[model samples]
Target: MKTSDEPIVIEECYAISQEKVWRSITDVREMRLWFFATINSFVPEIGFKTEFLVKVEDRNYTHCWEVLEVVPNEKITYTWSYAEYSGDAFVTFELSKKENQTRLKLSLTVIEDFPSDIPEFSRESCIAGWNYFLGERLKEYLEG
Candidate 1:
């Protein structure tokens, strides 16, 4: 259980250039390979919007996202929410170059509370999902 005020933060350092990491995150083609396979379109520009559906168990979650901010090769922020759920959140990805490597910091801030009845919406699940995508999945895609 997580309070609405607490943000989920995950950081990982990748042995790749910031440009490559940025493309993997912002490009829909690269993202679908590691992040979300159902992501139809993604643009790292302010006000760009995209929607996709994710099925968990018997429930369908319509994920609606709108780009809030973008700093090419550096940072991007998006407003993330579910069309069928009463919740609002902001997902921000920041990249910093350290010599030959890039440090990626991901932060997810919940603005509105999601239904507690759904186990998938729990804080633990959210943290685990991000860790899997950023720590394992993305690393493998980039390093491989």
Candidate 2:
């Protein structure tokens, strides 16, 4: 499938507190458990940057991230790119309290079109990745 012009947004509701969800996303230690174990470090402060290597088969995709905006436990926005690819994107995580549960929304916006030849850059792949992270991995990490 071709890359969609609109941002890819995925939402999941977790039976956990907003604070817990925020920490899971912002704290490096918690993130490592569910998001990216290869991530060396991550900070929620604006302008902070981090890079990590994710090896898939024989190919290596160096994931680069830069914090753009942070609203404490409410929201965090960052830029996501790969050093090996000629594309750029922004990923935003937003949290809101819904009764006793927390609603997590992940938004991915591609600023530059990624290489069409790369299957990992496809829109379906991106959506599936977010679903696994937020709906399955993070949910199990938080509630399990």
Candidate 3:
């Protein structure tokens, strides 16, 4: 497993209400629209588990997730890992009301090492992927 001392953080301030942004991240149906296309189902309650497969080029990654913590509309945390990989990580989503808008902060921290040989598992790739999902796709989904 690959180890890292730092967590990847991505923050975005959207012109939407905190409730809307919280729903988009915590609700399974809303997540499918912007978070992951392959997410079959998800629940915000602690201990809820879900897995889905994602294909990148010729490689298939079975992403497994288990909810670890939840704070209503404020925050959620989950354990993230791959079915056939050695890496483990924690993903957290936080939302705060900033006047009429919402500030969303996404954080991903590596708990164990992942296969270093796979380019898709690299820190840079992970950051880029999160940026695409939380920064671009989510923004478009909310603002559009």
All models: lDDT? Answer: 0.92, 0.91, 0.89
Instruction: List TM-score per model, in order.
Output: 0.95, 0.96, 0.95
Best by TM-score: 2
- Model 1: runs farther than 4 Å from truth? 1-3
User: Each prediction's Cα RMSD?
Assistant: 1.2, 1.3, 1.2
Question: Highest lDDT among the candidates is held by which one?
Answer: 1
Q: Where does candidate 2 stray beyond 4 Å?
A: 1-4
Q: List the residue pairs that clash in candidate 2.
A: none
lDDT of 3 at 132: 90
Query: What TM-score does prediction 3 earn?
Result: 0.95
| lDDT value, candidate 1, whole model | 0.92
Pick out the ten consecutive residues of candidate 2 with the lowest summed lDDT.
1-10
Off by over 4 Å in 3: none
State in Å the error of residue 46, model 3. Answer: 0.5
Tell me the tens digit of each residue's lDDT in model 1 across 1-144. Answer: 334458999999999999999999999999999988999999898999999998988999889999999999999999888999888889999999877799999999988888889898899899999999999999999997
lDDT of 2 by residue, 1-144 (tens): 234668999999999889999999999999999999999999899999999999998889999999999999999999988899888888999999888899998998888889889888888898999999999999999999
Candidate 3: residue pairs that collide:
1-113, 2-113, 2-114
| Clashing residue pairs in candidate 1 (N, C-alpha, C atoms within 3 angstroms) | none
